[model samples]
Target chain A: MRKLSKVITIFVMVFLSVALSFAQGSGDKLGDQSKLIKTLNKPLTFVFIPKVIHPWYDVVKEGALAAAEEFKKMGITVNIKFDAPTNADISEQMKKIEANISARPDGLAIAALDPATNTRLINDAIKAKLNVITFDTDAPNSNRPLYVGHSKDFQDGYDLGEYLAKLINYKGKVGILSGSLTAPNHVGRVKGFKEAIAKYPGISIVFDRPDNDDLQKAVELTENALQANSDLVGIFGCNASNPIGAARAVKAAGKTGKVHIVGMDDLPETLQLIKEGVIDATKAQRQWEIGYWAVKYLVAMNQNHTIPAVHETGSRLITKNDL
Target chain B: MKKFIKTKEMSMFIALAILCLIMTVSTSTFMTPYNIGIIARQISFIAIVAIGQTIVLLTGGIDLSVGSIAGLSGILCSLLMTKMHVDTLSIIFISLVLGIILGCVNGILIGRLKLNAFIVTLAMGEIYGGLILVITRGYPILDLPESFAFLGQGMIGLVPVPVIFMLVITVVIAYILENTPFGRNIYAVGGNSVAAKLAGIKVENVTLYVYMLSGMFASFSGLLLTSRMNAGQPTIGSSWVMPSVTAAIIGGTSLSGGEGTIIGTIIGAAFMGVLANGIVLLNISSYWERVITGAVVIIAVVIDLLRKIRSQKE
Candidate 1:
């Protein structure tokens, strides 16, 4: 009985330590640097809320922090607070925004999960006199001053579609695996892809499915797609997870080079897969630029400096040769 | 033969057969060996997890932590291989042992402490799920060894390696449930815990062992998926918890306990696999796929319930 208690105690301690470590948000202090010019004396705090807690947003946070470091060199104290919901939930995100608003930060930048609902919240934040901006995902109808992120999701998808069509010589069946069916970005990409491929007389889309942003679901759906269309020659992944998932299925089916794959985002797994030749190319979004510019623009807004209504941090297509 | 035909497993098997028949007729590719192999491998992961869930359900307990354990185990195994440079065999052994230990924790909390199984496992599930995100930080562990891929992608005489593992697990577990005293004790405890204790059964020990087995099975499935994907994905098993329970329930496992079979769970999983595969093969719209799948599950359970009513009356 005593030994059992000891084992239980150890387990509980380990769990508590791990949980406590992860409780804090991904915010780090900037190093000290001699001031080039004493422009601002007071420390400014800004909060960035993304759709969910994902590695993609983590990269964005890195950019926001990098901007903070730049301001430190200018003798400006910029404190960045990064917070996001654990799951991609609208209500949870709304609650975070509300809480941050009440906290009265100098600025708030959000990646809208639902444009309709977030537009209302963004308006409310503006009414509260807080400088507001948007990033990654934009709520155009909102009162926010500027949007800093990639705005050409459809064009990027079209480019990928054209590339895949050419790779397959414009005469083979293709499939598309996207993230959520409702996400505007994913939907736009899918729409653009179908339009681009429709120009090819012989190329036809045989299967289209949503993996709901799950890697395993993406794998299963791709496997099923491959089985359903035995002669499928190309696949388009409309998000970060799906392309890697699709590549895994293609490799397992022993059709690595036989089937061409193009996808969105430059997740580490997706890049490795591209290097391995299992995947042909991916659309690399400028996540760091979006973060850096979001903070920069938010500071300008606070200082009453005019900023552009849209700051497009564009994306580029990455192939094996690019890597 | 009449008695066998009247069984719940028989009803489920019929449903599965009907699904397969519809797919085979609707799509020319559905019945081919290639498609069959894909379906078999797809179902094997869920089928393995459902086996352990079936045991826990037989004890009138639910194991919500199965999915989280699977995800964490896969991540840990990948980390060990990539960061620690551990050998594949030792890593597999270490992961299985870790799974057992994790399950044992749940068992002790619920079995020894006499806590509510639902609440205990649910909390444990959240803890394990959070641990995965913390460890991986929402990134997949990539660059697994090429040799490890055999566990997920290899074929032996037209059968997937994971499928073989699933079959072996099913047979061993089936034998234990039917032919062992411990297995019988599990049913008794679920049927009536006080009565089981009065009959000199160590109910706590049975509960502990069942949860341990559940953890081990979930971990094994996680390992197989990691090998198959050739990367340790943090989101590997997030979508599995609901399916694990659904598969057991569809296979005719009673929610109240002590009235399910291993064969029923396998057929249940296969039914779901065929349903998903058929939707794709028949070119069903993506928007309507979930609605159709949900409707099919309801119809299957209703048919099983009606069959049970008829058998009871007769």
Candidate 2:
């Protein structure tokens, strides 16, 4: 019994140390930088909220905590509190923002899911004297001082469209799989893709299916697109799941090499597909930079520094060779 | 034949026909063999799960955990294959067994313990979601074997394998609900549990089996999806709970219990599938798809109610 108690005590000690390390790992310190700025004389608390709890936002949270560490180094005890809804929900985001407002943090950074529905709440956050800044899907019309995110969604789609057209030799029909139409970024990408397709008159969009960000629906849409358009040469997916879904359908039909696929976002499956030659290419967004810079900008603003109205974190074209 | 005409399934059939006619007129591609194949394949997953849900509903119980069960089972199957080197067939078998065990958890709570079905399943769904997150950490499992894809993406002659699975499950369920003594017991249990108990029927067993069956079907559907995507996705089946209930409800399955047909549910699934296809084919703004679908479901239910009232008056 004494030996068992000693073993239990050792186990509890090891468990506590492991848990403590995990807690500290989340509070990443900012890496070496070329420029130096004054640290805050007093401790300031900041809240960072994302649209949802996802792997993508996990990177964003890393950037925010890193920024907090940077502030801490400057003699400011920057307390960073990160909170978000369990799912990608707009109303839940609003409630979190409201609670943050009640807490009266020194500043707040948010990535809005529904900009229109959130515009009033954002304005209210500003009305409450909280330094509110938007990242990722921005609330442009809101009273927020700066919007730090990717370049125009249209340009991203246009580039993919042009690349795909050239790959197909400006011929045959192509299908476009998109996310929810209500999403501004997805709509912009579709418009840009259309504009690019218009330049290649030989290539026509046979069908466009909205999967509502559901991967299963994305698979079904791709199958239907292939079935409905027998002459299809390629597909362009506007979201992470769209390309993976399209690739599955293409592979299932034994048309992998023949049917080229281009998609947005560098999801793990998308990267795997690219490595396997199932997906021709994907446009990799600087999601890490979006988060990293958003927090940096928020910190500067908190310190009475003026920032740009729009910060464009550019995208990269990733192919098989790049992988 | 005359009695068949008066049935709710006939009215739903007429609605589906009218919807198809409108789609055909609006889009030249709507009636193509390819498009029909897509609709059938797309309806298979929801339809299969709904068949299980319909069984539970016939016993006056709701299974909100169907979607979560699918997600959890798929993730677990994917993990076993990727980490443990489990063979394809055995992985699927183990996943289905896991689903049955999970369902039995609910069965024990709702059936044996006599807890509220809604609350029990809702809480269980949360537990399932948490377990999936713990296992997957929000990342997809991509090392699916080649042989596994056949179950989801393969075709026999002209029909997709998933569609075949859907049809087989539907036929078996329809037989069980219509011809078997256990089928009558289900109706009896749902219609009146006290009377069913008085009539020498094992009410608790029927309840437990239906929930178990719901879990099994959900797990099977998840495996099909894992095959289709060629990966095990953490987010698989997140949008399924509503559609499972919707398909059964639209198929003329009474939520209050004791009235529904698998054929009606199949037609209902087809109706929804076609409506979505029509929106895409006609080039209507995709934003209107959800609005239109919601309106159609309401209109379909209202028309059915009106038909019942008219028949009573006659």
Candidate 3:
């Protein structure tokens, strides 16, 4: 048994090292082309790191690839390397950023999962002579220049809040289903929603539930809010899965079409709910544009150190009509 | 009845009853039929998974990969149903077989090959979980057939279908544990493997079967959850591992092995479900839920240790 376990451990170590070396080799291959323009003599390589591997990030990858294609058309030979942890983890993101930096890419783009832990890493990468840009999530305290990302999450939430209020005729009790309270983006959205709802004196935020980004918890929170508040006319979800969960809750409560729901993000389930009229609307982040512009900005920064410090990629509000 | 009250399982039941009473008194919504139905349905998933964990625990082993098996089976079942146009029942049958196969891998590795159960299942979990992401690409499979939802979302009169499923499983497992020779051998193997081997029991086979059952139960839960959500979500089973283990431990299943009851695990899962419901009903901050849950689990473990020491003295 001991010998078998030893063999297994050895096999796993060999597999991991092989995978790691492949990751490094692929990153280096992008810059190996010898023939290029005088100004862009060496093939420029940039690594785009997201918080995790999700459908949202897949769309972002598409945008980055599109930008890479455009750069290639311009004879600049821009190689955009994309990688993320299999799951959403801050430490994993940190490790990936460190690995990317060691690969000696011309530039690096990352969506920081936590500003405090990642800011120092971003600064270290800058010190290592890697031009760093952040998209989707920004670390303003870091020395990295240029943030090509979304509009204020607060505005996204405020718009959903105001839109939900109008959908319910501006006079009803509403509940806010949010993700983790400590998450900065979720908090900002909730703040904006609260501020927006305060304008209409008739609209009151009666219930505040944080689901920790679990679909089950989100559903339970929404259901409990409904059971507690019999007169709840609307629910505003400040995270991607919240609206889908709220829609399920509303349907289970037999309050479909009666209870209004607006959530953030364009998850497939959320879109299906909107088409079914279970959800009134959803705030769709411009993930593609965020990715496209981040790569473009990184390339421009590598070519000439003259790029804007901040760029805002706006969001869209999707309704049943859009479906 | 007096003897029942003195047993650890009864204490767990009392804990559940006390928690429910507190919730009912604190919030009018807690006693409502809607809230009760939702809680019952929610408890069903964890309860089913915990049964598998309890059996594995009883056999002096752990299966951390149950959650990943759940996720893999759900995604695979959904894909078979929607993409290949297979009927729902067949898809479920296929998932059960797949679960057994996946569990057999762990069984062979740990039971036959004598690898450490903890490390073997943990490695298997990562592999299965990784497969889930690769299959779905982090997107949910949203094209489930309408008929499939009946397993999870349907109601038999006032009780939800999932709750019914939970009850049926509990009864079957309870009967097997109390009435079957195979079940008795499982306890024997867990109690002392060398002694059981000396007594002509096939310890390796018992270990393999328990893990296979665990895998089967976990996959059953995966299918139910996928049906309830009306999609095959890659995130379906990530949060289940701890809760299932917690349910087993809280129900008086000793981690060292050879002692547990299905009834006790049912109450343990119910206790957890009620606690979460109470937190929501009382308008308590959700941020405190995890902290409270961890503290309560620790308290349960301490109490279990105390009971063991007292029983030893007796």
Candidate 4:
């Protein structure tokens, strides 16, 4: 009986070792990998990555979540994954991208930080025959097959510029506050915004303050810009967080009523400011559609549904009327 | 000639001039008072933190917790003002002292306990960041007193209050770094711990004070930010870590310890702020701003390297 017990212990150890090695081998085989063949015999799975897990993405999350629920009954098992590089570093994001590809999901929806940075990853993902699309941010040069967000970042900027221009009745020495000047999306918007403002004739972006996505810097920049451009009659914040910082500075300077203010995103402060008439209106993009289409295409491609190369998500001009 | 020619200070000064020139030419609006004021005021936050970072960097160490500390304290002070019904005047004082305490803990762990400065501060940053989020749940504390807000937004005549704060801070810190006995001891400890210990300077105390000072500066930036926004936000200090390092590095300060200047860091901070502002003012797309920024950072480092090479040759 003792000899039999010893034999059982040795057998259990051998089984555990074999299982561990098998698990290890599988993990290394597909680390964040998206491969269509992996789902050929199983339920289809897809992962959607945003710029970061911001409250703004909550809307996108809802849209994707809803779609996943609908597709579950169709025998397509979709898994939603998320990651945020503490900062925008291409190499840092590449690690997550590599892991996603290695995991060998059926599809991937990405919002890359920069086109230049993701060039190599785009090459690898395409070579491996994985389905990919962009939402919110796009890698235009990369062969990602489809871009599901705004057709172009410049259009989004144009939309913002048009909204502010018409609201101010196309006349004012206006200042622009932005988060980062280097972001392709923001850059596109700036170009479009500048062109759109030219149509206004009287409206000019007197001072352009780039806060590097830092809210504190945003406030300081706005305050200085206001001081330097005392002739400024309006302010248009170019990103989600800039409006509050700009508005706060404007309010502090006792110029709330004297200057027209317009900004982006519906942060509680921006919403409050709009409600209180501190800011005229805000411009919101269809983040819900971005996430929805990104995930939908990812899942469909897994099921062998070949879709279009680019899916343009339009921006919504959210004035007090819409809110 | 060699000693004077290849100085880190000279290298950083040159980089600052080049960046100024590039931006000045690229954007017609870049050199205006409005833009200059924005850059100078904007740099104050990072410059303050960099002063502390410089101290840590001088000791051949780093502090990742400064950003978290700023966020955490910003939330705390804002909450106190808005929720606890505490007086804003008292709240600012509490935040400043809290900064010192936080820095002291970092100093103790690294200086006294002999822990790895990077790991200790990194973990502390996480712990503090989580604590801030856990307490506030990722929202800004609003409805701060105007008097409190005034400290951040109020200008004393033509100068921004924050820039004034920066100037005052740099002057005092510079004085200590160059003159005070305690300051001299700090240099000794940073230069060589064993040698300093043998020379009878209390190395542990000096190290402790430097980190504590770093925390205080971060807290000051947080308080100023709080006033600037008239709210306390948990996410306010998210990207501060890099700029603090960037300012210190570009200012001719070595990451390996033993040399630096508060003024140089202030200039570096201003340089970063100006570069970003110039790109936007030139009507460049916001997205391309990052490309320009990344390019500027690389250039600053390269310029520093060339200066080092030149100094070596001289």
Q: For model 2, how does the per-residue alpha-carbon lDDT over A1-323 read when each residue is reduced to its tens digit?
A: 99999999999999999999987766544553323444456677667777766676666667777766776677667666566655564433544565556556677888877665466668878997889988887878889998888858999899999999999999899988977654567878888888999998799889887787778999998888888878789999998778899999999998988999998988888899999999999888888787678778777876777689999888899999897
Quick one: best lDDT, which candidate?
1
Docking class of 4: incorrect
Q: How does model 2 fare in lDDT?
A: 0.81
Give the CA lDDT, 0 to 100, for residue A277 in model 2.
94
For model 2, which pairs clash? none
True lDDT of residue B293, candidate 2: 77
TM-score of chain A of 4: 0.79
Q: What CA RMSD would candidate 3 show? A: 25.7
The best candidate by DockQ is: 4
For A1-323, candidate 4 gives per-residue lDDT tens digits of 99999999999999999999999889878864454344545666666656654677778877888888887877676767554444554333543455455445567777876554454466666776777677777778878888887745566677767877776778878877756654656656667778888887687778876676667888898888877888777776777777788878888998886777776677777888877677877777777887787778776676666788888777766656665
TM-score comparison, 3 vs 4, better candidate: 3
Clashes of 4: 32
- Enumerate clash totals for all models, in the order shown: 0, 0, 0, 32
Report the candidate with higher lDDT, 2 versus 3. 3
| TM value for model 4 | 0.52
lDDT of 4 at A271: 81
Taken over the whole model, the C-alpha lDDT of each candidate is 0.85, 0.81, 0.83, 0.74
TM-score: which is higher, 1 or 4? 1
**Model 3: per-residue Cα lDDT over A1-323, one tens digit each:** 99999999999999999999999989877885532322667788777778766677778878988998998898878776676654464433544565456456787888877665467678868887888888888988888788888848999998998898888888989998878654678888998999999999998888987786778999999888989999989998888888889999999999998899998889888888998999999889888898888888877776574678898888899998898
